[model samples]
Target: MTIEVNNESGLEIDERAVLDIARYALARMRIHPLSELSVIAVDIPAMEQLHLQWMDLPGPTDVMSFPMDELRPPSRDDEEPPPGLLGDIVLCPQVARTQGAEAPTAHSMDTELQLLTVHGVLHLLGYDHEEPDERTEMFGLQKAIVDGWRTEQGLEGPSPAPTMT
Candidate 1:
């Protein structure tokens, strides 16, 4: 799977770290290699505008997903995906920074952003948090994925991944 990340935000985020995070989650989840997702980092103002325009919200959000709907698996004879574009995930680094500082201590903004990318990708794969049970399931999976990354990197102590809203 190709996890293409575009850093539109001014913050200096580690691309390799983010990619590793995505790769780890994808590998863990066993997502098909033909699948792909994009992560776009944005500033506060741009996120605010997108949130307002797309979600009808006034405040900037930590992350927003514009999923491209469910994928129709290839036929028995088909060799690859019809289109690799899974959809786009827009993230606000400044908002994430503010939210992360106040959220879980082990959930750093970088870690949270990586988690958000996975969450967004899952949404693109037809996962939703409309129901409480679904929210729990998704959150559990996300936490485990992020925590796995932190653990593999030799980060000491518990790493509390971000929860879905």
Candidate 2:
């Protein structure tokens, strides 16, 4: 997969980790190996503008996904998905740090970013948490993917999963 990461967040982020987690999630979810994805880490003001423009919300959100070709994760028995533009995942490190500090487990900004990376990838793959059932499924899958990636990376298990409101 062609995964490009650009950090304009003004915060010193571990861009490699973000890219790794995104790639891991895409591979785990069985996306086409030739697919393309872009991840941008933006500053608070940029994120806020995007939030208002795209979602009509007032504040900077932790992460926002703008899917391009609308790729979907293939089932285990299904053939691999065709290569396409999987789209952009915009991450706000400032917001992630604040949220991480506020979490019950008090996760590091890196961990939070990694989790959000996976969450954004899921959104690109057509997983959503708009309804109760969808929330459960999406969050559960998100947790599993992050935790699994952490375990493979020789890192500690994941912190609590983020709730989508």
Candidate 3:
């Protein structure tokens, strides 16, 4: 998969880690290798504007997903899946930092961003958390992906209930 990470948040962030996490999430989800994805980090103002325009929310949220082709994971009975644009994952590091500070589990800003990146990618892959069942499934998958990635990277696993806000 073509994973592009653009850091325009004006805050110092590990762009490489963001790209790696995104790639790992896509790979774990069994997405096509030729699928294209973009991860953009913007300032709070930019995020707020996007939130208002897209989600109709008042302030900047942690992350927002703008899907393009609405690609779904291929099943075992399916043939080779077609390549397509996966979509864009917009992130607000400032919001992540604030949320991280208030989160029950102590986590660094980088960790928060990583979580948000994975969550956003899941959303791009057609995951939603609006309903109780959907939230359970989405959050479960998200935690699994993140924990697996952390294990692969030799990092410590987060709390059993990592904050998803």
Off by over 4 Å in 3: 77-79, 159-162
| Model 2: per-residue Cα lDDT over 66-151, one tens digit each | 99999887766657578899999999999999888888888878788988999999998999999999999999999888888888
The 10 consecutive residues of candidate 3 with the worst lDDT sum are: 156-165
What are the runs in model 1 whose C-alpha is more than 4 Å off? 72-83, 104-107, 161-164
For model 1, residues 1-39, the per-residue Cα lDDT tens digits are 888889989998877777787778766665567677778
Q: Against the hidden reference, what TM-scores do the models get?
A: 0.83, 0.96, 0.94
Model 1 TM-score, all chains together: 0.83
What overall lDDT goes with each candidate model?
Answer: 0.74, 0.89, 0.88
True-structure lDDT of candidate 2:
0.89
Clashes of each: 0, 0, 0
On lDDT, the leading prediction is 2
